[model samples]
Target: MIEERNPTNTWIVDDDSIYVYGLKKLISIKGINTNLSHFINGQEGINALKKANENQQLPDIILLDINMPVMDGWEFMNEFAKLKPQLGKNITVYIVTPSLDLNDIHRAKSIPEVAEYIFKPVKISQLTEIFSQTQYQTNERIRQYGT
Candidate 1:
């Protein structure tokens, strides 16, 4: 789900065409966030972040897919963490994927950028959890500089 506390600007990323289509539809039909954006892969997602940063600010939260090609969530998180010192804002990230493997969960937890790891199929409750974390961090963006 995309970030939307009140009039939000957020994004969702996934490589699976059907998954993307379903998520976009589910998000919209469920009234998730009309202001939300979508991306096919981690590269596109990260590029969008760079562009957004240049324009105003990056997304407040990101629903990142773990197993995309070329640049997966693991790679995305690596690059995103590099921007933490320069962006000057803590952008909350949630790892959303269908992988239920213990290794995936353990690896995701190892990354400081990943606020949470949620397995698919995605649910409204999952979005609520991500929003909760986003709310907590958005309220203290300055305090999470090291994050």
Candidate 2:
């Protein structure tokens, strides 16, 4: 078993059990110590994010799965946008999907909050890349957007 951390987060939104297992496995294998949180759908993720926002501690990262049962990643982003300046600098979202569809990739590329569109069966390398990208991007955003 992996040791859980406090402050609620590096998060994931996915309905599939196997993917969740694999993701958790990756996090553990990579020695990621952040609080690992998950939600079955985007709505739940949004609710948690909202609560976190109100509490002044949104997640460090959000791994969003595209094809979910209710309220998909796009919807989550839309909902998040309406939250009245709740999310701070560290809250970044990444689209994690098994699909190789070009349209999906294109769409992911278009979204600003979406830091990157990562392929599923997500590897250690991808995780490392994501970490680097997110760190750089977040810092740039904080600089440009101010906090």
lDDT tens digits, residue span 2-121, model 1? 533443456787888787677777767767543577888889988888888887757787889988888898999999888777774456788989998999999999998898888788
* Model 2 superposed RMSD (Cα): 5.5
Error (Å) of candidate 1 at residue 142 is 14
Per-model tally of clashing residue pairs:
0, 0
> What's model 2's TM-score?
0.79
Candidate lDDT (C-alpha), each: 0.76, 0.77
Which 10-residue window in model 2 sums to the lowest lDDT?
A: 1-10
Off by over 4 Å in 2: 1-8, 132-147
Return the TM-score for candidate 1, rounded to 2 decimals.
0.79
TM, every model: 0.79, 0.79
